[model samples]
Target: MSATAAPPRAAGRPRRTSVVRTELRRGVGPWAGAAVAVTLLVTMYAKAPAWQGRWTDATDTLHIATALLAGPLTLAAGCWQGGRDRRRGTLELLRSVPRGRLRRTLLAVAPSALWPVAGQLLATTVCLLATWPYVGGGRPYLELVAADAVALASLGTLGHLVGLLVPWRLTAPLLAVAGYVGLAVGTYTESPARWLSPAVEHASPWEEPVWWFAPASAVWTGGLALAALLAYAARPARLRLLALLPLAAAVAAAVPVLRLPAEGPWRPDPETTRLVCDDGAPGVCVNALDRALLPDISQALAPLNERLRGLPGAPARWVGGANAPGAGEIGLPDHTMDAVRGRLRNPDLYLNSAVQWLFSDICDSGGVTEADAERLADVHLAVSEWLAPTPEDYGVPVGPGAQRHLDALRAGSPAAQRDYLARYLVADRCDPEEVPVP
Candidate 1:
């Protein structure tokens, strides 16, 4: 037996990675990826200050940029890629290959479906890194970024299928426009269905998304894309029934999303909402997210703190976040508007905010006559002005009467000013009649 029959050469499957690499090189994949990256970078760069020092703002901005700008671009690129075989008269040649139709379709779609996701991930990495040095608390939401990537891949796959079905030359551009309009309208809708769209806005940077939202969103978008691909590409008609599996998964995932509250997936983030206080007679406290800004905030409010020191009914603490002001505490105004790069953009404006909060308790104007209401309002204005003069360009309406009262209060000795503030602090603002006339 001249041979233990030389071991038969094993048949090997073509290397999937090699095929993908080839497709990426020859197809529009790199261009698509580059376009997405450039788009995201440009948009984020334009609004750098808005998201620079906050993790929530950074992630939310990236999500928005991906959905609004990169999503349509990916769809267009996928559509163009899908139509290439037919346009080049290679569809028949592709069909003649020994590979199964589904396998062939997947290989052809590799470039279109994967590139945009890669681009998004790349952009996300860059942004999170940029935000790392600036942010004070709370980690980036990596799951949300992953969910966005999945959504982009799904969009690309869907666009590819659409291109295969529609032979029109303008299909790619038209589809892109439609995708943009649909996503834009979804973002503005009051209906809960807007949550299904990946472009939903997140207004509150202090809130964290629920744990399950990112996974559910991934399933919803990914399932639909997979089901559509199987339905269109499966060779045997019976195998198309397998599409039901992912379609069902998509429907199941959609139910919870549709039932989500108007706030979408977010809840108060404890870490971000937790208070970090500075040592003072009347301690100054800000949320942990703004912990780095504590010294700045404490310094800004120093003058007001001195004026209220040891006065009855004066706030024992100045606190921020959702914490309710207690018997001897006053709620701090949202400092986000006044802060930039971990410091107050305008300390005067911030001081003005604290002064406004000091007088924010609702007064039962119902008991006060119109003329008295007007007078109390003027006195309130004067007190506010004396504490923190509204920046001249800040646009607050300051009447001459309030101006005169403010000047009088300012010209008084420190002891007299303290005595007046002590009485004013204890007066029941609700009873406008009891409010001290400044």
Candidate 2:
């Protein structure tokens, strides 16, 4: 003790800060923080281009990145760190120290609990910065970032609990594998029960952007972490039952989210859905999420719009939601932010496919007969050829049948082909066979 400092109030009763500091010293020795950092870097490295080249949407990228980097790997690290004292024959010594087991365990798990979250947040900060230029046009959804962080922290704490209970050498790796598989399968399933899993849900149109759903996951996971902490810390058999209160609370909070039909924690963002129009006719408007893509999308669509000018049944105003009231409204390309690669793999081609959807009598589905299926396919092919003449245009694909029809259309007078396209587009129903592939 320093010469000026007073003695402790009682033996075994060290200052609270000193206790936490001691735990940090012990927990950090295992290099848990470094492990978290390394895991994040290794995982995000492969998707480096996603930060700028493709997905450029910071929040969207974080959603997937957290799923892969934040939780499972940190859990593995936590498992190893939690068991260190026991493995080194220090647990009983630590327990004998002057302090309640609750305070001691809390201090001990703090580093294990926090390093993973710190790593996630740090990596996320880097990714979020890349979206700065897009800030005015569209903002990243950060609620998801917080939710995922809570989930990772919970996993970290739970891993520690597992380690204390099972001190085997293989515990760390097994927990890591289990964590990854649980998250992967939980996200993959359509079941609502699995919806309670820590990963972010897939973004969907049916679900609007609602704030509560995101944090509810945090509430649920945070409860689990706290419960695990209490159960592991307390020596009295009855105190462990108190852990059930938080667990029950967690289930209560998760019910509303799990009951949701689609994979969701979102509802529509009206501000996001608010249309931002491009310069002129045939007019094009994009939703806020895709607003940054508008400049490029507008430029890409220019040739198509120019060809469509002054034609009957051609779209007058292009709306992005993919719903056209009549021939006057066309659905401009809305880039779906799937978890994969953070963006559609091929924007132009996917957009071209949207155009094909617009012209179809059925618009891409419904129990159709064999003859109708063949017919609709032919009509879609012809429409696709007309809209995107070259498959090379921004990666738009032209199938064999479509390419043959496109070649035939190109051979004909431009006026005649345009007239054919105009008629085909507005048709309520055409037997696909009735519509010439050419």
Candidate 3:
């Protein structure tokens, strides 16, 4: 029985799971994760109203928070962790271990690289869950979130390497501050290179990111980090040449990012931007992303719509988005400002917005004299105020003359008011001569 040939066992390989558990237990791993979670949750709590009911807003806010706050914290934490072996005077012992230098470095770097990402993912899950019920359409951008996690891990690894190379204790804090400043500056730059920074801001809530952008960003940041690790941790000097492969990959990934427009990676999202209309005479159409708010918006605009319904030249549709208003359509003001948790916070304020949208066309002041412009402005204000009275708390400036006109319009019989509105709707606002008096 060949003495029951013992199962061939690998010589000195440590169990990966045991090593990972030990790494996570010791060092800054657990603390870093807790700090990141606490910081993100607190920041998101303070700004909850801005993103509570909107998927795009929620994701964008999370991205910004990760890039600005969590990222720096991770870098500092990684730097602190990297210096641990040196601080404990275990560098010689680590060097003398049978494990390969690269393996040792990777094991040591694990806590720094993985903890921050885990924390961010946890925070992201909480935020997305909170936003789920309130949001009507459009899914959260998980790809972008994944890319942000990769960027955090890359920053952590780089900070770890810096910690190993730089002996000073102050390097962590200084690096964190520098990282924040660099990210903030990149956000404001006009150059396309700003896209390379993980902190790029997205201004349009209706837009989705380009399909390839997130993957490219992950590759760009991850490749650079891997390259650095290979160059530094490889045993023989000749093996360091292998770092060039990842370095080349990083450069290749950066090309498309560098070629991106100043607006970064976003493109118009047809699904989110598609119009979802109510069944009213002068239909109210909000973007699909805000479809849940349609009932509230329609109710808020009901009075104005009642007045405009069946009138000549009145808008056939009150449409929200970048779409140009056609012959029988008018652009709707952004309703997101008036909404809180998918409900209208102030209906009167929203009504005022609709009234303003009815007159948003800019007339060439160049053609009109100052006095005419002032008169036109007052008449416009009176008409607007009559259509939808400004909320008292808004502190809207109303001149005595405009107030008198508004009062008169309100005091008039329904027939008279309707007659005046009929003429006003057909008037070309750009021409002072064409505008009807209130």
Candidate 4:
């Protein structure tokens, strides 16, 4: 019979669906994925900042740390995977039997490229889930997650290409150490490259991860990743030159971030400045960041509110600010535990902050006579002690002069002391320099 036309497909050809699985079974395995997961989790814990009361914060921090810590390991894994054939002395044998050289090269590279990303993403996903019960606002910025994955994937490909070029056993470890140093230097220096290190970003009351960074970082790293993957998989020497096109593209994409000034990868979200209010008197408003803190804050301030119940010009609301809080307004700490992280780790500071806010610049009455200012200054500690008589302020080490004044105030009728205290508080507006005690 006449030879029939060759069948449209070959039965022995490796199916695309099986490539990753085949690579995993033959070379890559759960160990690499597990190592990645453990390393990322450890990094997250070791440098983990106090939780910023936002879901976006939890997710970004996990992935940012994963991006930083997993990078070198991914590079090592890639190097190890890329040199496998050379290490086993099977490169010639594999070349002879391959369905195609590019396909074979891809088969070698696929596992290293994809596995670490999967592991890091899994770790980040687990972290995001942990925040579900506590963090209520903001969606998981999956864009940042995607950027982290691409950055890691690209790192893997670059390392793999480096391994293929230099097949020594030391190549992998040395490359990892070099990668780690590069990361470290990037963090400590002034070059634009430093921002590229995806280490954890501290959140502020006014800002969050910038919206555009997701796309910018993805494009930058993805381009470089494509270039390296193409360079590694290219069968013909001439085709390797094509890698430069993507490399150049990556360089171009990085310019905007590189040019950015030192202050931020975040922009102030207007929502953070809007007032969030509580139910009753001595009203309180916190920025979006501190809204979660409002209940605790209000309850803490209840006693102070009671003291101000009938007083003129007593602050009616407390808000986050450096100043310019309206009249009868109190400004929270400039550091404002508003951005206080991690399970209110600084609650004592928050309380101290509240007390400080009310007492801040209390002696600055603009119209006071010099003599009145001097008189006001004399009793300043007395007024401050009344605001918060905590041990730190009223206890030992206070000067004898201040102690005598405090004792005198305490010695007088409680009624007279209250009358004097009330007079001083209102005097900032009405009588610029009246003292608070008898």
Q: Please give the lDDT score at residue 129 for candidate 1.
A: 86
Better of 3 and 4 by TM-score: 3
lDDT of 2 by residue, 177-222 (tens): 8888888887777777666776645544323456677778888999
lDDT of 1 by residue, 171-196 (tens): 99999999999999998889989988
RMSD of 4: 4.9
lDDT of 1: 0.88
The segments of candidate 3 whose C-alpha lies over 4 angstroms from its true place after superposition are: 1-14, 364-375, 428-438
**In model 1, how large is the Cα lDDT of residue 293?**
82
lDDT of 1 at 360: 90
Better of 3 and 4 by lDDT: 3
Best model number under TM-score = 3
TM-score of 3: 0.92
Clashes of each: 0, 9, 0, 2
Error of 1 at 370 (Å): 5.7
Error of 2 at 150 (Å): 2.1
Q: Whole-model Cα lDDT per candidate?
A: 0.88, 0.68, 0.90, 0.68
In model 2, where do residues sit more than 4 Å from their true spots? 1-19, 28-30, 48-57, 135-138, 205-209, 235-241, 262-264, 322-327, 333-388, 391-438
